[model samples]
Target chain A: MPTIFVYVDQFKGAALSASWETMGAAKKLAGEMGANVTALVFGHNVEGIAKESFAYGADSATLCDDPTLADFRAQPYAALLAKVCADGKPDVVLGPNTTRGRDLFGMAAALLGASAVADGIGLALKDGAVHVTRPAYAGKLLSTVVAKSRRPQMITLRPRAFPKPEAGAGASGSVTKVEPAMKEDDIATKVTGYSVEEGRVNLADARIIVSGGRGVGGPDGFAPVRELAATLGGAVGASRAAVDAGWIPYANQVGQTGRTVSPDLYVACGISGAIQHQAGMRTSKLIVAINKDAEAPIFKLARYGIVGDLFKILPALSAEFKKRLGK
Target chain B: MHVVACIKQTPDTAAKVEVKDGHVTWGDAALVVNPWDEYAVEEALRLKEKHEGKATAICMGPESAKEALKTCLAMGCDEAILISDPALKGSDSTATATVLAAAIRKMGDVDIAVFGKQAIDGDTGFTAVAVAATLGWNALTFLSKIESLDPAGKTIVVERSLEEGKQLCSSKLPAAISVVKDINEPRYPSFMGIRKAAKANVPVWSAADIGVEASQVGAAGSAVTWPEIYPLPAREGSVEILEGSPEEIAAKLADGLIAEKVI
Candidate 1:
């Protein structure tokens, strides 16, 4: 039977939720193809991580454990995965669409002579080919891609796109460790150090986001947007135009080139919908647009549109929200 | 130090890429450098201006691609090269990466290679990493910030953007990378830069010159082929113009949301 390979990713010790979710999708696809699912790990202590993969519906687990690969670098990590995939030869390779996963998958796909699909929201099986849905035209539309090749087909699934499955009734599946191909110089890049934006809600986990755009006018104008976000207990985002205008920090930008979000509620204030911005947030469950020009393209995609000045509407909405919450 | 920035000429972002009979087709072409690639050119020039090195902008596409390379020359690249040939049509990401790695090798000495993380049209996210692999060089991707470059140590550190957070890594020299929008603010093309780029000579190379076989150059050589493509269906939606009173429009919109099951 054809085998499916899923990367069991780790941040500290536990498997990242997205990795398991990817495995869940892999499980479904593999089951559809009458294929068995396998999991691959390449970090410190493979024993602990291997157990989680079986619980997620993987039938087998291969550990590429090495002291050198304790930390992930593109070259060594990619090389290790490539070596394993070369030997094991799974029919389809899957990974989370995280930055690291994207980098490693692209490199590994080239080495393996495979077709790789990016930003996969869900999988579809048709005519014995794997089709994936991804956004194009800046998120104005979704494109379905089918890899026309056979064997070693690959895709990076977006995190949280598919619902996560709970641990199965049975215990962890079988585990096996394979020696990885790694060397000191093989890891051309090394983790130097790291820092993150302080005290802000991680956008991925945020349920709501209130994003500002150039229509917000200036840096001072973001006050009401932030106020609305705070009243609603949401994180704040900005359009590239706003970030480029120096009205907000680049870290707050939301669009195709910026970040992909699945917030439950996303409120856009004073933003014209650019394709890039729309691509990032198009998947949000609920979208509200407040802009002076109701003709703004953003209003076309918005579930709720307030065709008035955001400067006027935002303050009023913020006040109403606060009053409702008795703040 | 020498930097090679790979630029691609593409239809403007606004142009719809129509795939007919399994080929990507665009409307009457208004050729421009791929939007993401402009950042690659801008970042290369900035690094050159700051650290004193040559930035060579190179591209592979139709003859029109020279215009994209010219922009690189305008931005202050010391040299420009275009790899264009009729035989090179429909080269997949793998073929393109191999050909580019071969060209970089022919350039003799290269310190770093830079590219925009992904092109808007294909969004493969493969070519940069593929080039790095074929040339046996290290690669770091999705770079947002370059904290510093220490050539003396033969290593530089950069911060890569993730969906939720950031990753900082230091890598050796002679590496290749693809940068995201967060890397650096790409400067506008100045008049003088435009003039220089327009006049700069861009020698065109073919498959044989790069030691790439015709069998490995275009669709004929591509491993993964496009079997089929259909115009994406228009989003299923209709506009309800809410006018007159706020209460009336709000209530009408609420009804519409309920009708559409969007609420």
Candidate 2:
């Protein structure tokens, strides 16, 4: 029987929500392959996360605790993960297809000489080997790939691609402590510090997103966009044009060249839907576009479209949502 | 100092994509350098200019990919190399990275390697880190700013853009770094440079030429197999356009969304 190890990623001492989603994918694939699932958590003094992994259907958990592992330095993390994979000799490894996952898993795959499939949206088993379906050409095409290499097929599941398994109360599992094989000189990268921008919700984690585009006019134009987002208890986003025009920061840009967002609801204001932008938000559950041009491309992809001046529409919508939601 | 920047030829960002015969076909779409890699090329040129080094453009693809290398050359890359092999069809990220790493080794004396955050086609963003690992070099990604570099000390510092914020990181020399668009604005290919690149003979290498085993490259070496190729799912239902005064339309849209419990 094959054993699967899923990395439980943490940010700022908290478990990334995508980690559970990855567990959901691993559990499904494990069932298909008749495999066992083990969760791997790494950090400084993160024993609690190892226990929490059990609630998400992990049969076992491993924790690697060290002061050097405190921050997410890529070299040390990759070295430590390579050591764990070498020691565990698992048949498969799963991780969330995020920034850190992309960096860590690639190095891990190279070290283990395993097959790597990053940004996997679909997983299945065929003839005792795993097959992954991932997007290519900027989500214009889906490519199903089967790794024909040795054991320990490593893959990173796209964020929110799989349903996050509900945590079970009092779920039981075993925990193991693994000694890392990292030398002090092996770490070539050091994270000196981090500074999180204040007063902004993460676009990836937001349930609703209100986005602006070039039509937002200027820096001050984001006021209404923010107001609508606030009224909806959501986050704010910007099109690459607005970002490039210096109207907003790149952190809020959503598109092929920017961040990919799959919010429950996406409200596009003054944005003409370019294929580049659509690639990022096409997976959203609902799309609403408000553009001045009646024939803008955004209407084709929007479930609800309103053609008008966004300056007049956005504020009104914000007010209406506030009155209707009574919040 | 010597740096290598890897580039890929991809369908333009706005091009319409289609799949035929279980394969992706570009269909008259202009082939251009991958948009993300533009930053990598830009950063490479800037670094070479600052450090008085040479930047070579390396790529693995069909012969047509030479067009992308030409663009890199036109953008001030000192030299261009293309890794092309008949046996290299359908190579995955691992195989491609393996080829790049081997090519870099053959070139020798590479102090730094650069790439974009992700290719616009695969959007995998795996090659840079994988290549770094394969070369036994450090990897840094999403770099927004290159603060300082002490080539003599073999140390470099940069700010990496994360979801939450920017992180200050330092890495050793002989590092592979992927740049975000904010790192630099890519310059357009000059007419003279384009003329030179068009006439420049980019050296092409096969699997054997790079000293890589055939089985370790192309489809045979790739772990992932693309069994099927298909278009994305179509959006369901029809769009409903609400028209009225801004206030009235807003009110109706809110009520409708509320009634559907989608807000």
Candidate 3:
């Protein structure tokens, strides 16, 4: 039977929740194709992650534990992954739609001479091929695609697209150790160091995001937006216009050119809701827009909208939220 | 040092994208250099200026894409090339990277290559890495700053902007980098630069010029095939504009959000 391999992505020795989600997806695909599901865990110490993968429904877990594999530097990592995938000759390979996955998967695909699909939301087996559905044109369109003639078809599943699988009744899967085919000398690039942004919630992981746009007016205008976010214990985001205008940093920008976020609740204050901006937050579970112009395009996607001056609405909302939350 | 910056012409962000009869139409939208690529061009020009080297703008698209290359020239690119062929349309990121890598190889002396983090269209953000893979070079993506460069040593250090923080990375020369907006400020075209760009002749190359097979250049070479595409359904509800004073509206909205437990 063909095998399906799930790349277990981790950061700082902690496995990402999306890894389990990918394993869950691979289980379904395995059921449909009668294939065995294997989780490939690589890091400095990934034995625990391998065990966890078994509970998440993998038939086997392959571990490539090495200090050199801790931080993801594409070349050596892709080389090792490509080598493992080649040896296993899996029919399908799955990874998370994340920074590491996006950076590594294509190189692996090229190395294996396989088809690579990005940002896949839906997957299925059809006529001996894995078909995928992905958003195109900035989420304004959905395209169903198939890697018709490729083996070890590669796909990066969007985070949260698949639900996590229930843990198995027992830790029942086998663990195998795979030696990396790459050596230190083969790495052309090195990560010298990292500087973490202290005291801020990552927008991608934030359950609620309070984002602003040109409607925030100027750099100082962000104070009120930050205030509301603080009151609600949510992250602060901005539109490209706001970032470009120097009102906020590009790190906070939420749009097609910026980060793609799918928060449980997204509140937009003063954003006009251009297609570029909408594309980033369209998948949010709930959307609310506050704009002075009732006819603003953002209102079209908003579950709730307040058509009034943001200068008045924002302060009032901040006061109300603070009072209600008692924070 | 020779630098090559890859650029693409995309519909303006304001355009409403529509699909009709399997073709994408963006009504009345002018094709311009991708907004993000402006930073790439700006960074390339900066590097060229600092090193006293030549920077060339390269693109793969229809004849109209030359306009985008001209804009690059106007922004101070020393020369430009347009890789155009009928067989090259609808190319996926991998195929696009293949053609671009071939073109860069044909250039023969590109010490560094620059690209935007991602184009507004397609938005795959993988071409730089794919190109680097094709060339067996390092790809330093999401770079926020070009911290240092050693031309003689053929090494460059860059600061990469990640979701949580910044990472300092170093790579050898002959590296492909995809830069973010924080790298530099893009300058507007000057009158002299505009005149020079307008009068300059841009050389156009076909698939054969790059030594790529027809089947490996366009849709035929793509790994993924789009079987169906349509606009996302419009949100079904009308905007229920709160009709009250600011305090009343705020109270009502807060109550509603709290009731829904989405606050």
Candidate 4:
């Protein structure tokens, strides 16, 4: 029987929530293709993550727990992943399009001499092959791509594109152990250290986002935006103009050149909404625009618009939300 | 040190790209070097200047791609090359990487190959690592800063910007690195440099010139196929502008969000 392999992306032992979402997508695809879903987990001391995959819908899993795989060096990880797919002969392989996911899958696909469809928003079985629907031209158009005859069709699912599966405590699956493909000495890249920024919600996974733009005036302008985001338990985003103006860090940028986000609620504060900025947040379920200029382009795409000063509007909105939600 | 900056020609970021009659088109929109590639070219030139090394720009596209190469040259690249072939049309990222790997090999002794984070059009962000895999080189992607470079020792250290945080990494030379927008600010081409680029001779290589067979390139070599192309469903823009005092407007908007169940 055909099998769909999903890579379980974990960092420091905890699997990313997107991995479960990918498993959900894989399960759906398996149902359509009459295939089994197998989770592939690789990391140091990641046996628990492997076992947890079962609760998220994996019928079986292959685990490679090695110290060398602790840090995500593409060389060893891709080599091992390529080897597993080669040995298992899975019909399809799916992974989340995170930073490491894209890096690993790209190199692994090259090693296997197969094509990988990255950032797929939709998938379906068509004519005995998996067709991936992905955004092109920075979300302006959607293209359905397929690996016509490549074995182990590789694809990376966009974060938040699929629903996360509910985990049941009693769910279980068969687990298999795999040996590391390469030793530490053989890898060329070395992870010297990591500096993590704590207490900030990741924009890619955030359900709600409040963004600021040039009209924020300066670095201090993000105070209200940040307050509203914190009140709503969401992430704060900035427009390219704001980032370019040094008002915020590049990590907070949202646009074609920055990060593409699809959140449930996207609130635009003091933003003119350039096309490039629209490219990033057009997929949001609900858009609210707030700007002093009624003529701002953002008003055209927003479901709700407030033509007033954001400084006053943002504070008022946050207070109202605080009272209503009893926060 | 010899650095090769790989670039592509894409529609301007402001272009309104649309799919008409099963084809993607950006009508009357100017095509320029991919926005991200400018950072790559800028970084390559900086590396060249710092190490007194040679920098070359290479691109894969039709005859019109020469304009993109010219932009790179005008941005201070030492020279430029365009890899073009009639048979290279409809190539996927893998096939394109294969040709690029072959081209890099044809150049020979290249110490580093630089690329942008990703092209705005395809947005795969896969070419740098794919090329590295093909050439058996270290792939350092999403690099925000090149901390140190030791040409004599053949080593490089860089800070990679990942989702979780910034990671400091070290690698041996002959590496392929893709830079993010935070790396450097791209400078506009100088008047003199623009004049030099207008007259620069960018040699175009074919599939056979790089010793890659026609079967190993273009549609025949691509594993992925685009079976369909279409626009996203149009978003309804029936915007309801809220009125009244700031407090009143906020209350009404909150109620609307609650009704929509998106908050």
Question: Clash pairs of candidate 4?
Answer: none
Please write out the lDDT profile of model 3 over residues B52-110, one tens digit for every residue.
99999999999999999999999899999999999998788888999999999999999
C-alpha RMSD by candidate, in order:
3.4, 1.6, 2.2, 1.0
Q: What would the per-residue lDDT of candidate 4 be over residues B85-168, giving only the tens digit for each residue?
A: 998998999999999999999999899999999999999988999999999988999999999999889999999999887999
Query: What is the docking quality class of candidate 3?
Result: medium
Winning candidate number (TM-score): 4
Tens-digit lDDT track for model 4 on A35-64?
999999999999999899999999999999
Candidate 2 segments exceeding 4 Å error: none
Q: What's the best-to-worst order under TM-score?
A: 4, 2, 3, 1
Q: After superposition, how far is residue A124 of candidate 4 from its true place, in Å?
A: 1.0
Q: Scoring model 1 with DockQ, what do you get?
A: 0.42
* Candidate 3 chain A, run of 10 with poorest lDDT: A180-189
Error of 4 at A244 (Å): 1.0
CA lDDT, every model vs. true structure: 0.78, 0.89, 0.87, 0.93
Supply the DockQ value of model 3: 0.67
Tell me the tens digit of each residue's lDDT in model 2 across B1-263: 89899989889998998988877887898999999999999999998999998999999999999999999999999999999998888788888899999999998899899999989888878899999999999999999999998777889999999877899988899999999988988999999999999999999998999999989888888887778889988899878999999999998898778876778
Query: Of models 1 and 4, which has the larger DockQ?
Result: 4
- DockQ-based ranking, best first? 4, 2, 3, 1
- Assess each model's interface with DockQ, reporting 2 decimals per model: 0.42, 0.78, 0.67, 0.83
Best-performing candidate as measured by DockQ = 4
